[model samples]
Target: MKIDDLRKISVIGSGAMGSQIAMVCALSGYQVTLQDIQFESLEKAKALLNSQMNKRIVKGKLTEQVVEEAFARLSFTTDLKEAVSDTDFVIEAIVEKLDIKRQLFAQLDQLAPPHTILATNSSTIVSSEIAPATNRPEKVCNMHFFNPALVMDLVEVVQGPHTSDETAEITMALSKRLNKTPILLQKEISGFVANRILGKIMNEAIYLLENEIATAEEIDLACTKALNHPIGPFALIDLTGLDVHYNVRMERYAKSGDEADKPSSLIVEKVERGELGRKTGQGFYAYN
Candidate 1:
């Protein structure tokens, strides 16, 4: 199906990324259903969307009327069948676990319209691993959005082995419609492009910390001051959540059986302590 043919969009999961993605589509004049199992999570997503839109309006980035219109175009639901029954595209932004994703996709494959295209917002896991669980593998692909999807412009459009050219083309066009920069990946890799590079940087930073070569502050300072990165590895982890970083690393290590791919002891310790980044008010740095 073509980009214009896609009217109803369903975004699964109402976490930081999922809510923003649904808002982005709504802002672009698409009917969006933001789905999660918990009503409380959906309510929080609505509140977050309002706060984000208000911030944009205050900064003269979006008009109040536009925000209202976007809100009117959005809906929240807990029923999975109701969410995807009529949607032309489905974007899954749930947890990064493979089995969970596969199970969700399999259900979506059965619920969504025959023309629906299934996309995952996973930063590390590729679509091929999840597509095999569904019958419509050709219509399944990865549409990886960076954290804070509303702010991040770059989106990685990944093509799995079974992904159709039409699916890739339509997704690329849809990304542009949402005012995002889309980069196409011809082949599937675990972390794709951006995260692989980012993972390497974060791994080395953790290594430096583990070896006691420098404090987190010093390493972050070097990255920002010398390397000119906008945020240091430690700070970014705090923003992205140490648990998320650790989980992705563990997944990679499991797949590769490489000790170098394993998560840092520091990350493991933080996760074990439930000191997950900004959400928990603590990580490498304290938000509290």
Candidate 2:
């Protein structure tokens, strides 16, 4: 399938990644349906997208007319069937659970049109494992986007055992059309590329904190000054949220069977205390 062949998109789940993905597609001129099981979640996601667009307009990065057109191109609903009914493609951006993803794919298999390609925005789970459960495993592939999917340029076009070449090509082309950089993973891997590298740095950072090597502030400052990194691993983890980091780390660790992949006790302790970084207003440091 060619990129132009895809006109309508069905985006399942309306969290940060899903909502951003939908906004990007709509802005790129595709008719987008943002669907979630919870109506309230859908509402929140819609409002958040609007807020983001407003901020961009205020910053002079986006025009109000473009924002209006983007919103007009989007349709929101809680019903899965209604969203996928006429979509040319489906992108599943649900939670990182194997069973939950498979179930969603199975339903999409029955609901979406036969030619509709079903792509997952999963960061860790193997696309191959999730594809077979669906009716069109050949059409199933991974289109993993980073956090703030719309703003991020890189998109991992992951291919599994059953993934067809055409499916991969279409996704790659779509990424370009959406003004994103797309990298091809010839084979399936646990962490793909970006996350695998990120996971290692974070693990070492946790190890440092666990061994009491330095204060979190000191560690963050050193990375920023020495490496010119925008944010230190600990600070990034805090910004990304400890619970999300822990979950992705656990999945990758399980795949690699690496002991170092296990998240440090300090990380878990912070998450347990609800110190979820910028979101919770505190983590390794407090936010005013």
lDDT, candidate 1, at 248? 87
**lDDT tens digits, residue span 1-288, model 2:** 677778999999998889999999999999999999999999999889989999999999999999999999999999899999788889898877778999999999988888999999987898898988987888999999887787788999998889999999998999889999999998998789998888777767777877889878888888899989878888888766777777776776777798877767787788889887877899888888
Q: Which portions of model 1 miss their true places by more than 4 Å? A: none
lDDT of 1 by residue, 143-224 (tens): 9998788988999999988999999999999999999999999999988898889888988898899999999999999999
Clashes of each: 0, 0
- Candidate 1 yields a Cα-based lDDT of 0.92
lDDT of 1 at 244: 82
TM-score of 1: 0.98
Model 2 has an lDDT value of 0.87
Give per-model TM-scores. 0.98, 0.94
Cα error of candidate 2 at position 150, Å: 2.6
Write down the TM-score for model 2.
Answer: 0.94
The local distance difference test score of each candidate is 0.92, 0.87
